[model samples]
Target chain A: MEKKYEFLEHTADAKFRAYGKNLQEAFANAAIAMTNIMFDTEKIKPLLNRAVDIKGDDLKSLLVNFLSEFVYLLDAEGFILGRIASLTINKTSQGYRLAAIAKGDKYSDKYETMGDVKAVTYAEMEIREEDKGKCWVQVVVDI
Target chain B: MPKRTELLKELFEEVPSGVGKGGITKLTKEELLDLLEKGSEWSLENGYGTKADLEATEESGRMKQADSRQVSERALARGKPQLGTLGAGNHFLEIQRIDEIYDEEAAGVLGLEKGKITVMIHCGSRGLGHQIASDYIEKMEKKYGYSHLPDRELVNAPLDSELGQQYFKAMCAGMNYAFANRQMIVHWVRESFRKVMGTSEGMSQVYDVCHNIAKIENHKVDGEPKKLCVHRKGATRAFGPGHEEMPEKYRKIGQPVLIPGSMGTASYVLLGTRKAEELSFSSSAHGAGRALSRAAAIRQFRGEQVARELMAQGIEVKAASWKGIAEEAVPSYKDIDEVINTTVKSGIGKAVARLKPIGVVKG
Candidate 1:
């Protein structure tokens, strides 16, 4: 499915708007948007492979944890997951669990740091379905 | 919509606010840093509060891995004298009453009952934090020419850059200073209350959280778990139940989310939910988003009239500048209730209790 992503400016921060035909596509696009904020997307290559699992009670929280974890991977391990191989989300009695594999090359050049996100906040967050058979999520990282 | 003039008038009179305003206590630089890193723990150690106070604080009043040496001497100097002082705008020490309980179980656990008086302290690293941000921004802008960046406001340096690390360390120290400052103020507030009521009945900290700051953490994104730095400006973390950070007592309920409203309105206490993990990096809004600019507020309201209105509502206020008062009128902010509602509706947090102001002290 085709997807579109846009960057929105916040007070000393940046937010991304991702639209896709399904949740997975939207999330993938969102990942692209976030990494693009730090470096040129075209320069990044799909080299290394990594997998992640996240749990949350709702889509919004899960999205935040997902993005945060991605950023963490880049900052701590210097690994960037440039491609989404497969993604699956399941709803459990406790919450939602997400499992997926990402592929990307390791960051070599000292990546510029944008802002240190202290923690994800609950303020002004929204996730909704668009008129097209697509889903949208608007998230504001604390940084 | 409420008239901005009337709103400004009411806010000026009820909420204590201003810049460079001193609070009831003073402290030295060393003393302030101790508070900064130690947070409420310093207060407890100094006999200003009890151990129970730490339980109510985020991170239990201590942030590990803070590199105080990274703090600049100038930043330290700026923070030294400001310790124990509430240096103005939006910073306040309010004495309030638990006028309502939204979730009885949560309120009971929080040790709050209707009619119980509570004190809320709102301030940050003050000059120290401001100086750190300023110094880093200038250095980064000069080197990176971030002015040409897509968003000039998002100016920053590489994470491993000397400037970046220094800012992080200094910022942590500043946070520590804030923790200590609020702890000291809590001590004074207790003393003042004891004096006013002629009783030694001590008060405890409900919770202490920083809304503006950054940190490093581990999370999973797109199924890949990684470590990243999270920065929250005008935001707060709402870690859910069973998280390692949650105090044992609150693990079942989740982390306490303190949401303060405009002076005339009600503040809320909420608990984090697991759902927040997906939504916002387990984050939430800090407060009602500003609805009016300070200049607009000042132009719309008269300070004196605002004070009178608050007094009429039985709320007592002490502020440093009438202009400051006029600028923060309650109407100038988004309805806090709505903001709280959004949080709950989004399933990030659950309402616990509501607090109404009885007395306020602004800087």
Candidate 2:
């Protein structure tokens, strides 16, 4: 029930900082922060669960690919995200891989749609771990 | 005369201006690839616009280097259903009238007459292009690694390297998709006018050019001519007069650069200047950038208030939701008049005419 994310001031795009007790929570919060830019996450009823498995060159790549999956779903399949049901990040022999299930409903007129998020950029992106084991992920999206 | 509100509603419904997916048409993967390869020609062949429209388009709406094979399956999937959709964000469709003409000859050549209505559509490759950039960033980082990069987003492959060429080709295809997307919308705009105003005649395209694109073009560097891959990121290519790459009619006047403003503001049409070649690789600022974030805009103003204010000013605006209107409020952007004046004074472009929005449809 702690603070998950807060919006940051940006000139042209949407910027946010998400927090979690650990990396999994931070990554999950980051995904929610992104979807919140377009629609209200609370309003999205979890009508379906999507399986996500993706590999990246490193932790940063893993985080990006992890979040980008939701963009694809919204655009290609009209899936509106509610929350990250479960997530795990594993260190692979090559690099990092992410597996998770995203819970959301198919997009419909019931949702209050705003601007579209074009893509997630690595611009000013940060992943930090602080004392007491709190992890924070900062992201800037091209809307 | 048909009511402006009626036409605005028709355009809003016809253009699919929302975050929801699926455009006016759905394409199979193979058919989508062909559209990417052919660009606006595919749109025209399908009877979207006239032959004159293609001639007025930059590169005639096709990039020869584009190969759909270079595009990833993921990009294709996202792009296939979005060919004719007007996407959300700063993208828009406006019915504007020539409010001011600074250069008489230039305005005459480009067919800008006082009080004449013109349709301006501002958009890009949508989800397809977004995935292409994401895919290449992941692919390039694996090969080149981002340990030394000042910005991870700047991670790039060598221009002549295999990976670089592959991304270049794929990016070109994305540009093609945008060209075709706008062309199809042009068709819809014509159709909307015919349905509402009862005549689609004299609705001809003036010019269409890419806002952000990296191209291998011949330019002088340090006083010596060289072929450079000029990446005009967040800029519009403002090639000067006599540039052979421009349309035959435009070669005498230079390319027509279209700059769309935020909701309830004025857009501008500028002619390319020769000095731009020497100043900054023949590029000009694309639009009046955001002065405030979407969150701040929403927190400060409601969409209903924004719509009502514009309506009071005799400008009719339509969008999917009130939240959409607030995010694009006119006060949330920098002074567009100042931006246009800066471009003209900097000598990169010449002010041809200023356009005032009479009706707008936002995504």
Candidate 3:
């Protein structure tokens, strides 16, 4: 198993650096980092799934929208995420389109929800392939 | 006030069940749309609280600028369900005891006294507000391309631009949602008190203030009054005595600024000072302010241990998650007393009353 993401220190909110072999993996890992912040991911079961489709004018915006959909599901539907089944990203003429199958379950009494995330802020949002064959994305969420 | 144990039990039992769900109170699309438009006015008209409560709220519980049409469909979808919820992370509803009075006259005006019990509700517009911000951030970044900006988070549109005005209207709707959300919680609290104590006496609101907001107000700049868009993030509006917006009863003393502290810590009630209007734009610190990240706090303390410590101090703790408790340990936050001292020393606000929590319910 590969390391997905790592949490960082922020004065007023939660921050994380997610890693992947490529952009799709990086976005999926970012979702994991965010959900893991709320509770122990091991306790969650991938019993249910949802489709995520987001459009952005650029790669950065694409990542923000992708993560934003998870935040929305959690708040609106009480859906807590477990794992990412698959993700596909394509560059379109206008911008970008990301389609993903997110696996998770409805938040239930059995799980201890650590925190509620407000938004995936653009504060420190950035993507880089600092090392060969690896990509890194940084994001700070307003809790 | 009822006995501490009884009060705490009532609060613990009465808080709406489940963390994220909107509780038993269901709202149709039309009703939620109305709430986004009217804010606390909807709550008042729906009989959630009294008009006096609105008078005590910032903007009188309604932002006339709020245009529900400006809110995006995605934002509305996220907000429609979470309308009356106690959001997770740091948000809470606490029953506290007024332990000290710094300004006797000011405290009297705000209905504060030593040993008086009070309820403090803290929450926001929930997913609706979050989605609106997410939607606009991408919009602004796409339109302006903020690569030159120091941080992408600083991406913004000119306040007078069409996109800027649209975001403003949507943000105002979000603010209104928060105002109405808090108002609904207040109603549930009164009912909770009545259920446990057989009466809702002493549950009257002292004041309700919004910390995160942008306001259009008149302020003197260079000896001339100018209308400015004042944005207070992580800060509260502390309008001093005689401000035209303050309630008639508070105009003589000053607007009430409720500075809540982390669980198991002391909270303060401060009154706006004349100095604030001159120096800090009539704004004061919102909380003790998070000094430690949640991850660091979790590593340093156990949630159960923190809960035990608070219980030993006679503060009852009820939360949906223990990890949530560990993440909000007292050591994770700056000292309330010290923060309040800074506010007083800077003359941004004057201390009026101090509160110690007896009961706390966190999401």
Candidate 4:
């Protein structure tokens, strides 16, 4: 799927703008924008592979747990994910379960820390899929 | 947003708030200065806490470069007697339980075994910090002309300017005051728990951080590393592993980022990432941003109802007023999970554990 992305400044923080034909593609693009904030996306290579699974009751919570788990993989295991191989998400009795495979490099000095995001906040968050197969989400990253 | 009227009502009744609602103890300027210079150390010296508590605090609960003289008399006066007090509006002291552990290793380091009780304090320099910001922002607005600036709220003064330095010093002093305030309150909280449970040995500082103010930091912007006076009004620093600022024990695990939710919701403890510096100057979200305005919140919910609901959920709440409780109701704020997700996706912080509130005290 083809996608477009941009970074928008809201208040003291920034939010990623993603446009795609499906929810998965939009999420993938948003993830790319998030990583691109740290390093040049083109410079990262898929050198190692890993899988992640997250569960939440709602779409918002599912998205948060998914991203949080992904970042944990990179920080704890030194894995810089370059690609989302596959993702499967479904509702469960508890909330939602998401399983994903990602591939990327170990580390690179070429990247820089932009701002210290303390954690994801539950403020001014939204995810919408347009009628024309376009999807977008706005999240406020704590910095 | 929680109904502002309801929150105000509950807050006014239960929590000791306002400009001059003194706590059980008061402090003098000299004592306040000591708190500013020493941070939690002074509180410990005064028998508020022990040495082990300091290890869990960020920067050992003190910013070394803070110059107290830069603090104005006005700021000092505001801080005096305000030390050891919890200020109003979103600032709180919550007794929470480690409801879930995502990373056992990090959770172990934080001294969290499932069901363990922890006290989370959410506050800043109180009136002193607010006064400093008010004074400086006024000066900067006059000098820079707010309408002409890129962002009206981004009024700034040069880092080396007299006013700038003074604000920094005063802000640091306020930070110290907050640290001392939390420390003193931690002592009281222990006392309170001891009175109820007949034990005081288990409580300890997991982490303490500031959500507002600015600091001079070294970061690589572009390709060269440079010093910049980073202003984090509603943000918290999330320094990655191996940074000099981190405690030696936490260096390998990254700095602890405490994100407290509203009265009955779940809070989070996250860790910093090296990738954070590139994403946000090594900063992250402070809390669940207000989804509803205070006024709107007060109009929508009743403090008594909110309190009752929370109590039914097994959460004990104490507030200065019922209206205040309404203003801080869970529905008044955004979903915390979303905020955490953005940070993780942005590669700024990683979640270590989720905390569920058991008891709360609001100012």
Candidate 5:
């Protein structure tokens, strides 16, 4: 089976490339990759769900806002991401909007912590459908 | 020996550290706003630290320009829950023993005695500051698209413009949040000492400085005094002696510059020099800057093996997870002694004392 994401080299932060057959799947996998950086997402049981609704000026901006939402959720409310059940990106007259339903549990001792993703950056962010029906997203996050 | 281990455990527990660990203080949205305005002065009023602590902190623990009203609701929410936390990722609470004193006069003035223990806490505004930076960065990018810029991260507004002023105010608020956060952690460290060694007295604060932030300051350019907005990103203040803004007690010795090494390495204290202001805008290296990526660190070192080696050297390490240990291996960073030596050789900084970590609590 092909991997969902792979960690990349970064001098002082975490960088990764998430892959999927489509943009939505690629984004969902990106969330998982970022959460896995904080803790093992496989150990997170989907005890609750959160509806993430955010908008941005463009696709790249949308990507940063989308990933940063998870950082905010974990810090503001003790919620960690286990999986992304659904995600959709829409192009509006102005820019874009993203809606996602993320399933996860309240943080607990059962989950092992590696580190926290503090913020998402545009340093080396990319959104591309390189091959036909093949999508990949690259992100550099400040840890 | 037991006391050392107990101190680490107690600190690790009292001051929450690691991923998913919330702050110890639970503040309402209103209280969070107040904190953003007052900074460490808020900590003093709330019975956490002392007035002297505020005196020793960068910007006196409060940025005068900070207006909490400029802070966004999202930033407020993110900062409210984690008021006193040492967030994960290179943030740490270390108990170090001062081992070498290079400048006896400066060390004596700073009260850094050889072989005495000192605590060092490295962290920032947590989610609040992060959210603030992201929020404004997005705001800037939205107003002015990054297509023409060198990098999207460079999307910025003119400092005199409304959007830029708003960001400056919000950034100051976030800086205040970081100040209060460190003050609260200092209280917890004192409590840990009391719980473990039965005495919390005589733990006078040395000094605290802010890096990775911007400041509006007065500097001399070509022998003329000018006010400049100094952005010390990934650099710390090394203010020279007799700066009017510094605390009076050490006005003759200069401000203390803290440069932390990587885990399991020697950290240094250097006196800020007038040459620093003239040569480098009074800024010094923040830490032993990362030389290797974290992914490489993890692939090359196991957490257990790393901990075992540090333990073999008589250093006690306690962390939220083994992954944290592996990711912050000492080899992953450049040599601190070399960095400080370069700073000293540049005449912008003078070595005061060298500190070796005896215990660490990773957040």
Candidate 6:
């Protein structure tokens, strides 16, 4: 069993790593990890579902876009989150495309939100493959 | 600043429906691109702020190198609705009173007097700027794979490279967006005051400066004039008196450096010094650097408790999210006094006045 996600220490920003058996799982966990920057996922409920479609030129770009879309939704549209329900990635001639369904609801006073995530940064963002076909994605978010 | 409770209540509590989400003026793709290209000039043309406000801003609130073509659709979309908003996280708008004056002459020059009320705003270019940075970092990393880079975040492109130019251009545009965004917010703040208090008293931009930016400048190196790209990250440019970049009114004195403290701490206004040009490349620390991480702060303190403590100190706290208050607690930041002392001792900045918060609005 792989760890879903864990926090890492950074001097000025919030850093984290998400682990999974494949890239897609790692990507999904990464989204949840970013959401964790704002709300403690355990307390939030999936009441509003938002579909996300993003195109990027590479795997790294795809992951960044996937996470950034969630940040935008939360900031611009007030779509708070419990989790990402379904996420899929496909290769394209340009590079890679991602489709994800984020399940969450408008922020209410009932749930516990620790902080607001301002943006997902490229600071130390990476995707790596491990032994036995495991994948790990790392990101640092600016709060 | 007084008798404006009703308007303040509405402005602080919710975004007006006509102003779009977050109480910001929404923009179409074209308008946003134009804004990216023109910056504060676009805001001024649209009647958001006055010419004096732009003069107080860095580069007169426009960076001519900005190229909207380099900006992406996602970046545009993310920034479209956020214009004029006081963005979330540690960003805030605060009402303060001048507490102490260190240099009476400099304080007078800056229009600050003891017990005088002032409004200070802290924010950034929002999602568009972040997205631009992300997009460029990826492009730079791919072009020059970061095999030798010690930290992945420190990815760089050669200053003369095509990709580097593109990044610089996009970054300038983002800087412009931030300028216009802040200008519009200032406009709204004045309106809110006028609508409720029947006056826009004590609402003015003292000096607006960018802490994170790279500018091509000529500085003396080894007694020879050399062109350098000065990048000030987590730092403020402290141009001394007589510098060409200084606005006409400020040229005889020095650039006004606004250093804001964390909640419950004292903020300072410092004058850029000539010694800074010799010692620090005309740069100074932006604020008190973080003493703890957000998680550490959350673990150690509660937002409601912090709010109560601030209220006890006669500081009003209004927040879109209380958790934000906890993450940015006073304990989470370094001592502003020590930071200012270090800055002054280093000969980079000269203390002019100190400000204590009376009211704060955080998102």
Evaluated on CA atoms against the true complex, candidate 4 attains a DockQ of 0.01
lDDT by residue (tens digit), candidate 3, B146-202: 879888788889899999999999999999999998898888888877877788876
lDDT tens readout by residue for model 2, B1-363: 147888988898888864765787867777899989999998988888889999999999999999899999989988877779999888899999898989899888888999899999998899999899888988898899888978888898998999999999999999999999999999999999999999989998999887677899999988999999999877889999999999998899998988877778899999888999999898988899888888899899999999999989878888877888898999999999999889999998898999999888988
TM-score-better candidate, 4 vs 5: 5
Give the C-alpha miss distance for residue B82 in model 5, angstroms. 0.6
Give the poorly placed runs of model 6, Cα more than 4 Å off. Answer: A1-3, A19-23, A40-62, A73-81, A88-99, A105-114, A122-136, B1-21
Docking quality band of candidate 1, CAPRI definitions: incorrect
Instruction: Arrange candidates, best lDDT first.
Output: 2, 5, 3, 6, 4, 1
- The runs of at least 3 residues in candidate 3 whose Cα sits more than 4 Å from the true structure, single-residue gaps closed, are A130-132, B1-13, B17-19
> What is the TM-score of each predicted model, taking all chains together?
0.66, 0.98, 0.96, 0.67, 0.98, 0.89
Candidates ranked by DockQ = 5, 2, 3, 6, 1, 4
| TM-score (second chain) of model 4 | 0.90
Which scores better on DockQ, 2 or 5? Answer: 5
DockQ of each: 0.01, 0.76, 0.69, 0.01, 0.82, 0.38
**Residue range B49-102, candidate 5, lDDT tens digits:** 988888778778999899898888888888887888898789999999999999
Candidate 4 stretches with Cα past 4 Å from truth are A1-143, B1-19, B141-147, B150-153
Tens digits of per-residue lDDT for model 4 on A1-143? Answer: 35467766453344667766776766666666666544455677877777777766577767655665444444334355577778777778887887878777775444332212223433455789889777887665432
**Rank by TM-score (best first):** 5, 2, 3, 6, 4, 1
What residue pairs clash in candidate 3, if any at all?
A: none
lDDT of 1 by residue, A57-88 (tens): 57765776677567556533556656678788
lDDT of each: 0.67, 0.89, 0.85, 0.70, 0.88, 0.81
Greater DockQ among 3 and 5 belongs to 5
Error of 4 at A65 (Å): 46
Which digits, one per residue and each the tens of the lDDT, describe model 1 over residues B57-115?
A: 77777776566776666566556545565545566666677888888887887788988
